[model samples]
Target: MEILEIENLAKHYEKFDLKDVSFKIRPGKIVGFIGRNGAGKTTTLKCMYNLVSPTGGKILYGGEEALKIEKRFKQEVGILFGESNYYPSQTVKNLTAVTKMFYDDWSEDLYRHYLQDFGIDENKQIKALSTGMRVKYGLALALSRGAKILLLDEPTSGLDPVSRDELLDIFIDLVGDKEHAIFFSTHVISDLEKCADDIVYIKNGEIIVNEDVTDFEASYLPRPPRQIRRYPSKRQAH
Candidate 1:
């Protein structure tokens, strides 16, 4: 089933306008939103969450007009930004104390489990956490709330290769349940190439490519030289 849809969406500003953007995200799939730095990747994501009001078009979540968004919808959707949103002085334990009140389904046990699994210390202050740890903390909180849809903004940016791979593994495991959907924006194409089922390429405030990962890669991206040489010509030594 489709969990989210963006149809003819538009967001206007004096400096830039995101026009004619559209896409759908289904359960058990990971959709990668990709673009250059100035593209409307973040803006489109914000529109989905109602952080930015769209100038035109419709956003539907579970077949309901999302512009008339509801609180239940908020509970179903989890958001993670590129940077930490929590106060630097707060410990993970203390931050959980504040965040837990927002979700009726919040589970302390699961939250703590994620903390352990992600190698995050509950007692450490948010300021002391590394970029990857902070992202993990955010993700832990989101999962604790029983979110079905994850909207992540540049989630792997600024991380070392190992950390990026670790997060990608977690993302792959998340959709294993077959009821969750992940839509994340990133300039890091390699990360998407590894885990994304579909890729949405945006350029200068518009969507340029929205297609299955295998098709796009096979049709658009060329094979590396090493792989190309694997198929030897008959003239060459076997």
Candidate 2:
């Protein structure tokens, strides 16, 4: 079943537009939104997360219109953007305290575990952290919120190769339950190859391809035609 569905979604701006984009993310699957920079990937993601109002079309979460959902229901959705959104003066512990009040199911243990795993210093101010460390902290908070749907925008863009791989593995582990789904947008094709079950390719404010990666790969493989022998000739003669 689909955890999220976007149909005929359109978002317009002065310079660019996301035109008639449509796709679905199934439960337990990682759907990669792939495109080059300025290709409308972020616009689509923003529409999905309700951060930007769309000019047209419908967005459904688990069969209900997303716009009509209750705040409690919307709270189950988590978004990690390309840049850190935390306050510069606040430490990780301080931020988590504020987040816990907003997320009904926030788990401090899980947050702490992720902080340790990601090598984030909980006591350091957000401004003092490196770009990659800030990204890691943002991810740790997003995942620890007990969100069923994660909307991640260019999450691995600034990380080193090893950190990127580790983050990908963490995503894989998070989806092992089959109750969660992730809609992640990234220009990094290699990261998509590692974690994406389905791919949605966008270009010039339009969706070009929405397909299962395995199926697309299979279609690219060579196939041989079967040959007919004497039996076919005999039938023709009869």
Candidate 3:
């Protein structure tokens, strides 16, 4: 069964317009939102969460309209943007404390497990964390709230290779239970190619490709990894 569906989704701005955007995210699957810059990827995701109002279209979560199921739907959805807007002075523990109040199903045990698993220091201020650590912290917060559907926008865009791989490993682990589904947007096609079950490509505010990853890869010419540098492991960096 489809967990989320976007039907004829469209959003309009003064200069740019996103039209006829449609897709489905099924249970136990990873759907990669792929597109070039200015392709409406961010806009589409914002609309899903009602952060940005859609001029036209309907979003359905489990066959019910999103607007109608706002309360229940919000609990099921967890969002992590490309760059989290965190107070630089706040520590990891402080951040989690503030966020946990919003979710009824918040799990402190799960949150601590992720903190330790990710090697994050709870006492360290947000400003002290590396780019990778910030993103990892964001994921921990989202997952601990018992989010069944994750909406990540460029979560791995600026991380090191080791961090990217680590995040991917966590994503793989999340889907292992067959209860979680993720829809993440990224310019990093190779990363998506590595793990995404399906790809939804958008261009000029229109969805041009929405299909299985294998089919999409088969039709397009392959490109090698962008960088060949050997990145130091987290242990080595520390």
Candidate 4:
């Protein structure tokens, strides 16, 4: 069964309109949500998470309307917009202590494993950790809360190359279980090329393409110029 499906999703504003955006997120696959900045990527995500009301369309989780089961849907879905910069003064442990209270499935063991694996110090203040570590910490919280689907917006937007690569590696490992799915939105095509299985491309508030990553790349990759065979000029040919 599909974990999440967005059908004919639409959102409108005075200046920008998102129209007919549709896609599905399945288990164990990373679907790269690709679009340029201001191409409605964040707006679409906001609508899905109920941060913004969609002018049209519906979202489904496991074949049920999300609005009908909003609480359960929210619990199963983890959304991280950039990183955990919300409580810069608080220690990781303290922030997590509060975050865990919202989820019934929160697992301390899983949280500790992710903290160690990501080299995050729970005692460190949120501001003391680097940007990359902050994102990792967010992931730890989400996974420990038993999120089956993660919708991350620009998760690696401002990281250094090494940090970006490390995050991508973590994404790959997270899906290895074939039970988790990631719908990652970004303007960074190279990041998708590294870890995305499929892509849902958007432009000007509309979906442009939805296909396997390889197919998307092959369709857009620059092709070599055609060779032109030229016979000798007519006057000299004879």
lDDT by candidate, in order shown: 0.86, 0.86, 0.89, 0.90
Candidate 2: pairs in clash: none
Residue-wise lDDT of candidate 2 within 66-89, one digit each (tens)?
Answer: 989958456988888975756989
Error of 1 at 176 (Å): 1.7
Instruction: List model 3 lDDT by residue over 1-238, tens digit each.
Output: 7889999999989989999999998888899998889999999999999999999999999999998989889999888896554998998788878889889989999999989988989999999998778888888898899989999999897788987888887888888788899999998877887779999999999999999999889886376768889999999999
TM-score: model 2 vs. ground truth: 0.88
Shift of residue 143 alpha carbon in model 2, Å: 0.9
For model 4, residues 1-238, the per-residue Cα lDDT tens digits are 9889999999989999999999999999999998888999999999999999999999999999988899999999989898778789999989999989999989999999888878898899999998878877887887788888999998887677887888788789889899999999987888998999999999999999999999998997456887999889989987
Model 3 clashing residue pairs (backbone):
none
Q: Rank the candidates by TM-score, best first.
A: 3, 1, 2, 4
TM-score for model 3?
0.90
Per-model TM values vs. the true structure: 0.89, 0.88, 0.90, 0.88
Most accurate candidate by lDDT? 4
Q: How far does residue 140 in candidate 1 sit from its true spot (Å)?
A: 1.7
User: Where is model 2 more than 4 Å wrong at Cα?
Assistant: 218-238
Report the number of the highest-TM-score candidate: 3
Deviation (Å) of 171 in candidate 2: 1.0
